[model samples]
Target: PRLREELKKNYWIVDNGYNSFPTQIPGEGGEMLCDDEIGDNIIGVLFAAQDTTATVMTWVVKYLHDEPKLLECVKV
Candidate 1:
């Protein structure tokens, strides 16, 4: 409810004859996305991003610990 209200307040639809764009909704080919689809996609992206960040951070820490010179270079 709050998300919908915020989106409605901040976003406006633009219709330029050939295409219609809903600024707050995620869509392609001029199709409007439903709230459930948008929510699912957002959740999926958040999980993927969180997983990737954790993996990258783990690798960075491992490399930094293995190579003191590389860590020093990064700090500088």
Candidate 2:
């Protein structure tokens, strides 16, 4: 896939956990991740992020329902 190729061509820079350190980190098995693994990880991260955002928003709305002044301030 194009994403895999781009990650490979860019030295697997996206999720290898070495962006600032400038080193190559291995996957769970001490090897570079295959294309499928990268895609799966991407999906996992997306789902996790969305779930977190939804939880935060739910809590915010719940609290807002209890505080009319804060909710009105937020609308402005």
Candidate 3:
């Protein structure tokens, strides 16, 4: 919620009242995200999660490095 204005574009609203990225449901005939919109949002979310994922992985490696037995078990 506190992301700087410059970084705000990194996140996207799937659909709001404006429906800037409008799409439609195939059979139901309702507004929804199309393939491109889905892909765009997914990419945004994944990129945003990168730092968090890397931090967790770094912690995991640090823990395993401190515990040889645990690391060996994980390798198997």
Name the TM-score of candidate 1: 0.37
| CA lDDT of each prediction against the hidden true structure | 0.55, 0.55, 0.49
Q: Which wins on TM-score, candidate 1 or candidate 3?
A: 1
Cα lDDT tens digits, model 3, 1-76, are 2333322333343223231332232212333457566546545645677754464455457768999998898799
Stretches off by above 4 angstroms in model 3 are: 1-48
Weakest lDDT window of 10 consecutive positions for candidate 2: 17-26
Model 1 lDDT tens row, 35-74: 5675465455457777544544555577789999989987
Ranking by TM-score: 1, 2, 3
Residue pairs in clash, model 1: none
Give the residue spans of candidate 2 off by over 4 A: 1-48
Question: Which segments of model 1 are wrong by more than 4 Å?
Answer: 1-48
Taking the tens digit of each residue's C-alpha lDDT, what string does model 2 give over 9-39? 5565434534221123356555677746754
Sorted on lDDT, best first, the list reads 1, 2, 3
**What are the RMSD figures for all models against the true structure?**
15.3, 14.2, 14.0
